[model samples]
Target: MTILTIPITFDKSHLITIGEKLYSESIELIRELVNNAYDADATSVRVTIAEDEIIVQDNGSGMDEQGLRQYFNIGSTEKRQHNRSPKFNRIRIGEFGIGKFATLAACGRFEVTSRKDNFAATVTFDKEEWEQSNNHWHLPMRLEAPEILKTNGTTVKLNKLYKKFKLDDVERRILEGVPIKAEHFEVYLNNKKISARFLAGQRIPVFEGSEYGIISGELILVSNTNFIVGGPGIEIKVKGVTIKRDLFGMEINFPQLNLLTGEIHADFLPITSDRTGFIKDSPGYHEFNKVMRGVLQRVLHDIKYWQKQKEKKKNRRIVNATVDKVLNALKKNPELASLIGLPVSPEEEKQKTEGEILPKKPRVKRTPAQKRMVSKILGPSAVVARLKIGKKGISCQLDHFGQDSPESYTESNIIYINLDHPLYVREAKNRERLIVNVARLLTQELTLLKNPKNARQAFDTQSKLLKDTLIDTTP
Candidate 1:
């Protein structure tokens, strides 16, 4: 392979945009700066909060003015694959080489101070530079000379913020947005330190059998119960239990983001899990998608997971609001019908749902007899669909009869049985408990029938069917 050389332009115009992204309205700025601090081998990065300003101070090997010019240069290739080294076992988070731009997106003014090899420097830029240049894309305004400190580190101060969101108020939210753990670095909002916590959780069932690759990936604090998958493929581990996983919806960002977030852990990158983990857009991300879909294809998958937590939170509000309306309607009507599944007028639905939800009807208690009857109707062997239970016998149909003392017993499905047809006798090849129960009931009715011959024939046929079912089920 031959080294390819191409002339790349570096001018004042491009420099100003270097840290532009870090100043966005909705974008995450601290995450970008924190990545930079990590790259500099900083084990401790502190976010300092001052009135109307935000500052990020790190104890990493600081940058001299020249180093600052090069490293902070927009689109600088200084972070070539060969020269760069990550200080931790964590995955890579900065890919565009413009993460610092996040500052410009959030604040109207920015400044940096650093010291390296006993040399110190400071650089500051403001909205005036951008406005004065007519947005000509000038290099970031450099004020480096007598650095703020002779110490070995850097401090980034963002001032004149957009104020759409207050730094002092949203520190926790910002901390939550970060993908790393709090133990990695101390985050502060307005001088008050903010502690981080993991997302909520529930029992995540592993694949029934064996896993395909490695388990025990990186840990990410996405949201309570939602951000379990991390590192290579997507794994979750605790003590003796480790789940092997693959493709997360995050792979969808691979094509556009390129390895912006590196494998935060050895278990996560799956160098052994998949060779393509480092290479973007290979089968890795796509494979990740396949795995994600497999885990989330079911409806309740989201009950314990999130494809994109940000989007999920937004959508959850909509669903909750609708449920609240339904509950309110039930409260006003004193009947479930007016609130649930009833085709009342739109005006009625709106009006009836104005009241607050009452305490859930104190859960109607059931007597043992009621429970027994319910067990029979909703038991594992209950015959679903339309069925007539009478002194004559049981006739399978499409409608349920209000029988055996009930509140108009009707259901689209029974508890455990999934028989597609009502009177279909050969339906269950394996001995189904419900089929046997129906046969037994048929036998008892035959014993009491006026005509014994017809009942006897039916019993014989059912007994044979039962025998066949028993054989199949036994095998």
Candidate 2:
């Protein structure tokens, strides 16, 4: 094998292009700058929006001349090597050393003023001058004494804005973007405080680990609403900073999922330079997704069960109303009353018909798979209900007069569902509605059992109503 080394060079325009294309929105530009402030150990950051300029001032340790040199270096790994911010021990969010140019994306010219131990230096970047220069160009730096009396901090001023950003939007984005709730940190936009509010729901702890430290977060199901608000879905936070908000992407497309919101704190996952999303192929990112998918499935199952309970309650009321109406109508009409009778007792009838001639039994030809499935379902004598998926059919059994019967009789509390049946196959696609249908069938059976004398009358009345509805809807 031969050893090879190549020096890579970058065009100034291309370097500028990456920064300009890094963010999709004007709010994202502000977010990146604020994150820079956070990485600098700034406890408080104030953003001021003027008609032609934007100013971000942070009360944190200011940069010295050496730090200034590294800051302007396009791909400097200084922050990665240093790792954490001084004084506060905050995790550094920027490593590529190109975040400063993000401001240049929004403006033609921008300046960084820093003060450290009565020593101050100001650096300015002029896009026009850089464009007119040779391939080699550098941001102009001016070292001087302090002009203003701020002891130790940094201030960034962006002049000649490329695009207008609404102050209110800037505040909203900051609130959603950064981890404002971290102790001792505060963000102010146009003098208004920007803070993070926890979602209103049952808090669920989420934790995972890799070569890095343990990653943790909370998965919550907010109250009342079926969709998440403020910061919907999950936020992927690395070192107490948001890398991607709504991490699940479209929230598994569930309305109740809107009630489901979470914050995933996994700094181990690597992100692209833009920081809008994670590198999907990374081992750490894959593990994070696997864990999150499990959490999402569990939450969805819980939501499904909860929905079923609510629907069951509502349907029970409807069943009771229908039963009452049938009983009342039967009492009012003599002809209907005559049709209502107590169900027959199979055991007593069998004893009385011992001398009668037996009828020929019909032979049923069932496939081996069907026979196996039937055995599996009927094997458990204690099981009151079962739903079996098979070829094109729906057969339900209701417990008749508290008596045990053969599998062939519709006298046990079991429901068999053939998924191959076109109607049920369509309903299966919608899980929520399918659950409701199953519950409705069970509720109807239970309602009949409650008033067995009126069951016939109630069933007849329902059948007539259904027929009338079918006729009315027919073209």
Across 1-475, the per-residue lDDT of candidate 2 in tens digits comes to 9999998977778766877777665457787788888888888899998899899998777788887776677788878998987777877888777777777668988888887767788888878887888765777788878756366778899998888888777776786667687777899988978877655667778776656457788877777654465456677777666777663653656666777667878878788776677888888887777777777778788877665555445433433443343434333333323222311244433443332221222455765544443554432112232221122112343221221222222222334333334443355456555444434443343334334457687676545433332223334
lDDT of 1 by residue, 315-403 (tens): 23432332233233323332222312332456655564444222223344765534544455442223332111111112221112223
Q: How close is candidate 2 to the true structure, as a TM-score?
A: 0.65
Q: After superposition, how far is residue 383 of candidate 1 from its true place, in Å?
A: 19
The alpha-carbon deviation from the true structure for residue 102 of candidate 2, after best TM-score superposition, in angstroms, is 1.0
Off by over 4 Å in 1: 1-27, 80-90, 130-151, 167-169, 182-184, 198-200, 205-283, 297-475
Best by lDDT: 2
Model 2 segments more than 4 A misplaced: 1-7, 147-149, 210-213, 222-232, 245-259, 312-475
All candidates: TM-score = 0.45, 0.65
The prediction achieving the highest TM-score against the true structure is 2
